[model samples]
Target: MTENLDPREGSLTTRPTAADRARALLDPARCRGLVPHDAGYLQTAGIEIPATRGFGQQLMRTRFYAGVYQLGRPIGLRVASALQAPGRDEDRARTARSLRLRPGHTVLDIACGPGNFTGTYGHAVGRDGLAIGLDASHPMLRRAVADNPGPAVAYLSGDAENLPFRDGVADAVSCLAALYLINEPFRAIEEMARVLVPGGRIVLLTSLAPGGRRDRPHVMVMERLSTMRMFGRDEITDFLRALGFDEIEQVTAGLAQTVTATKR
Candidate 1:
């Protein structure tokens, strides 16, 4: 049986309490259509039952991020856009310049939320190049397609850990903000490496909570709700190196880190 809770019903004030939001995060029915669900064995007859792992366990293996995107899509989109708005253009330009994307290079953007990086990449690659945006959420992909329309841009539904493309099809690849949310982040990185042509660049932007510091309340809440652990600089670098990537360069920007590496 699925439990449905509306985000608007409980609190007296317009805003929901932290507890309310947290409770909503635990609802299994919220993720029913978006991901698969598995029912575990019953502990005792009419006494206790084991909770199904569902898609949350299958992908992120966390209660916080199990149905996060599907549940928070509207607010999440706004938050993502607003946060990136301040440095959106400049960041995109810097990444494009750093990667040296030309008119004919194909770029793959993993977890390309709401077409932020996808639109910029599409523009950077120009008419001759292709910018493919892959994301697991259908609503996000719909918004991405609606917001970024061009012959050079395409959107697909896929998980980062298991990318849908063939080997060595892209000249460059990028994943932003959503890496830590993945359960097998290294597998996702391997997929990124797999999809890139030899010598192709891979750019990543993700949180850096060194020593697992939870200084910011919002960041802390997100991490708690999503059950995601941030990766340190060395951990990411080691993964890239082990995957045969070279010339790794990492730079910190506020709480986030940007890494650029070349597949060797």
Candidate 2:
């Protein structure tokens, strides 16, 4: 699933072959009156994609952005964690376990780059359940459609600040290593809370903040290299507590943090 490195091919073309299949994963009633387009995804109107610009945005639109993790090396989990700890294979399993999913439960994967975990979630939920991946990047969504095709899975173009689904549409929601990329991450988490049903599980993996702030080019370069936002956790933890989530917990791995909670 590596994208073209050739400068001439800045981005991959959107293939139509999987559009029909992805369409089947959408529930008519679940959409906020937005129809799935011919390119094989529903989108939030006026929402810009890639979330970022320049190098990082280009990287995410391609397959190599994730660059591996505890269980997925090369594009979905902790890159440093995979390299420093045991690499790629345990990430998805741990995430699934945290969700405590059951067969036939619907799941929404926000910021699902390349739809990597979308396919994983689909399998976890089984045939009767639905797994929907949402990302603002068209190339990522198109590539996701090509890379991960399943009867129970689909991809859409949407902004994290405002999820496009109606209230309480998902039994579980997972956002992995993507919240930091959004401008208003806590607001996005609130949106995740809005789409989830009562007692539903939520899981997130994001870049961990450094112990203290610093004014240094080295730190800035490191942040760019890893696509991490070196912001602290007071806001996130406080927000979760205010939301009345149960079992809220956060764990660190390499440069990443895994946060799990349940809607009240």
Candidate 3:
């Protein structure tokens, strides 16, 4: 069941400094109990959960609207992590295993909800590497920002379809469990393609119907209820290829699929 946590301060985007981020992560009241107070969820210093449009949303507008209207202290994100612990963890592990991340690489995590993979990226990139997380939800970003370890981590409030960074700036880009929420998935892929330097990598992990499309009954039911749009593996790969991504491969997990692509 979803729990409601209220925010004690202004929106997360308001005055996002290291001090604010630190407080939000360490001080439970600052983020309104958004981080779960558990060993598995809370022990990880670099993990943060971004605010999502609840579970199984269908419409992008509704998801965005839900993000905008949901008031009060945001629920601790670690709660979801504790409940759905490793929901899509296998896919993430698989993607992480395949990627060739090195020290000092500049990594960008689009839609880095709750800092799950963000934590993984932090581990992979090491202290020298820089990880930038981008998400549209303030609560989510706030929680993620709060959770991430300092120095190598930074969270930005922006849409995946419209990233606010210089072109060819990232050495690698990864999006975990967030692309399906985008209204224009193709456009977002284009943006991802545009942001990476030559030979930069992209990893996309998303949940959808069992097939390679977005029309599974169970998933459809969830989407209708949640008002969110989910995409399929084939569609995601094709979109990436069309956007000039090469060496695209799809890997399946418990309920979601992960796609890895390298920029040509």
**Highest-lDDT candidate:** 2
Q: Could you tell which candidate, 2 or 3, scores higher by lDDT?
A: 2
Q: Provide the global lDDT of candidate 2 against the true structure.
A: 0.70
Model 2: residues >4 Å from true position, as ranges? Answer: 1-32, 45-54, 62-79, 82-86, 212-227
Q: After aligning candidate 1 to the native by TM-score, how far in Å is the CA of 85 from where it should be? A: 9.8
Worst 10 residues of 2 by lDDT: 65-74
Better of 1 and 3 by lDDT: 1
Task: Please give each candidate's TM-score.
Answer: 0.64, 0.75, 0.63
User: Alpha carbon lDDT of residue 204, candidate 3?
Assistant: 79
Q: Candidate 2 lDDT, tens digit per residue, 1-264?
A: 223244567766433322343343434554433456666666754445534744555566664443322124444443545444333346676787789878888888898877777888888888567888888777677767777767677777878877766677789999986876776788889989988899999998777655433245765777777565654555466688798788899876656667899999
Model 1 per-residue lDDT tens digits across residues 81-104: 444333446666887776778886
Q: In model 3, which runs have C-alpha deviations exceeding 4 angstroms? A: 1-94, 215-222
Q: After superposition, how far is residue 149 of candidate 3 from its true place, in Å?
A: 1.8
Question: How many clashing residue pairs appear in each of the predictions shown?
Answer: 2, 10, 26
Sorted by TM-score, highest first, which candidate order results?
A: 2, 1, 3
Local distance difference test scores for all models: 0.63, 0.70, 0.60
